[model samples]
Target: MSETTEKDLYAVLGASPSDPVQELRRRYQQLALQYHPDRLGNECSSEAESGVKKFLEVDAAWRLLSDQSTRRQYDLQRRARELKQDWPVDSTVCLDDMTWDEDDCVYTHSCRCGGRFSITEEELEEETQRKQEDVGEKEKEEEQHREAVVCCDTCSLSVYVIKDVKS
Candidate 1:
């Protein structure tokens, strides 16, 4: 997999997101053993592609969230979400060069070209920041993503170690 969406890894593994590392490891091991290819019958013989795929998915999700480093990152992301939710995202906008029309109770902007625009202050600020980020685009792309072969479609198997996941 080139990228894994920012999912709650613990939830994906069917565990509480705040589960202890040791518990997480134990649960993952149990799931991995249950899903091992050796335990699965021949794919061609059984014709259970979807079944095998689901098993692999459960195994992969468990493996990713069980590890210390990956688990920590997932936890941090979860915390970030909580913090962001608590932040007061004020949506009030400020209008530029517009007198409030009592009839409409909305501010309007008149352009030199005889055009008009209506926007809140927040929208304008957000737009300005987005424009700045675009103008300062990175010169070289960063390969922030790490590849992992989380599943064997032909068989239900997975590896927990980083090296194993990579191959």
Candidate 2:
């Protein structure tokens, strides 16, 4: 739902991240009805096709953002991803130095700036999958090195979450 997200779920629902849950639900309901394929009738028109696509996207976005935990995870990932691209995330650190939060599935390292640098397990898993897809079976014999850049929650400092994955 944040501005940094590649696919802005908020924009899909015509809502913002700051909007209350009730407001989001209301907006979702309105959009659902407006774009419902049934409402568009049985006509095989371009409008109907567009409506169906929008309706599916709206539903998918709501599914991800409706849950409090999922939304938090999404927001965290989006913020970190955007910051990685814009901020000076030149510092590197291994995952062994970070503290793990089991409930949130996040790894955090305390920054000297009185903030925490965090990265989610989901982001790390995705990176692993992407690496697997990019390399051939022969390349899998070698160790995998991955890096996810994350920014401090309280300041502008960023770090590369570098880790080596065994084959």
Model 1: CA > 4 A from native: 1-3, 45-47, 81-167
lDDT of 1 by residue, 39-70 (tens): 67676555456556656776767666767797
lDDT, residue 118, model 1? 45
Cα lDDT, all candidates: 0.50, 0.80
Worst 10-residue stretch by lDDT in candidate 1? 158-167
TM-score, each model? 0.41, 0.50
| Total backbone clashes of candidate 2, pairs 3 or more residues apart or in separate chains | 0
RMSD of 1: 17.9
* lDDT digits (tens) for residues 4-24 of candidate 2: 357878888889888887888
Q: How far out, in Å, is residue 47 in model 1? A: 6.9
